[model samples]
Target: MGFLAGLALLLLGLHLIGEGLSSVKGKRYLLARAFSRPGSLLLSGLLLGLLSGSGTGLSLLALGLLEGGIFSLGQAALLSLAATAGAGAWVGVVALAQREVAEVLLALGLPLFLFRGSRSGGLVLLGLGLLFLGFLEMGQGAKAFAPLLSLLNPGPWALYLVGIVLAFFLGTANGVAALALALMPFLGQGGSMALTLPLIHIRRGGQRGS
Candidate 1:
């Protein structure tokens, strides 16, 4: 029950993450000017990933920028790199600060989502709130499943395969990483961590179709 609930919440959160950002596409255009310099483009991508917490979302944004001539293909590539870095950093931040972030988002998001117009970025706030909540729930599910799952040793390769599958399970790289950690606690601590990076990298490439 909890596992399914967590999965559903995660998927929904990711959907909102994509929609919320796309909703603010006009604002995202500002990032193109910020990307004028190589170093600044990377920094902009980093900040975008930090804010949106998803490389997939950042990639779509970059595509829009590229098509609109706001950025070159080379600059888009740089943006993708920085976006992944920022989103990777965000995973740790979310793990440690879930409670604080969740609380703030909820307090700010509920009313905004319900009353404020969609143009107000309410959906974005609500999506972030749900994203944090889903993480907390997923953590609980992991802890709950760990003990029962510990007995199963699927081996490193098999565990890694599972990690790859999970990484591709969600729209955002961060969500994929989170799901990888949540589902593979049976692989033991360091075992799962070892697989996460490669799995995320693979999924990012798949998402990029390159």
Candidate 2:
């Protein structure tokens, strides 16, 4: 139930962010110019992933940018790759600072949302807050299965299969990574690596197809 609730919050947050950002004037042109260079594009992708904490979220955003004429297909592909790497890089940070970030975003967003002119910005911040809160909830929910998971001596293939299914449902390698981090107390180092590796491959493949 907690996991499901977290998923709902995650989806809602992403949707709000998309809707809010889409309404921002001149953003498309600014983004297009910002991503003109490969270096800048990679950095931007990484920064986005770090902020959003979801490769799938980044992919969705890239797709939106592509449709908006702010990004070419090739650039979108590159951004997805860079963003996924960035999301992986953010797993530890998310584990440590999820609640704090969520609280900060909520504190800022709520007041800003009251103002008409800053509504879009407020929505974006609220979305970010929800995203982190969802992550925190999901982590807590996964703890319920820790004892059962610890009893299982699953092999690499089993772990990989589990990861694929999780990525499919969560729609992001980052989510899988975050979950794996949460389960590390049960899964241990080797199990976590086995679970995440295939999910990364799967996410990259999905990104390419998108």
- Which prediction has the highest lDDT against the true structure? 2
Q: What would the TM-score be for candidate 1 when compared with the true structure?
A: 0.77
Per-residue CA lDDT of candidate 1, range 1-210, in tens?
676677677667656666766755776567666568998888878876875777766777777888888788998888888887887687676566476787797688677767646534666667667777777788777777766666775667766676666665553456666766666555566676766766656755666594
Which residues of candidate 1, in runs, are more than 4 Å off? 26-43, 72-78, 115-120, 183-186, 194-210
List, residue by residue over 6-71, the lDDT tens digit for candidate 2.
766766666666556656334767777878999999998887667556677667767788888788
- Please list the residue runs of candidate 2 whose C-alpha ends up more than 4 Å from where it truly belongs after superposition: 1-15, 18-27, 33-43, 54-85, 151-153, 204-210
**Model 1, CA-based lDDT:** 0.70
Assess the local accuracy of residue 85 in candidate 2 as a C-alpha lDDT between 0 and 100. 78
Q: For each candidate in the order shown, give its overall lDDT on alpha carbons.
A: 0.70, 0.76
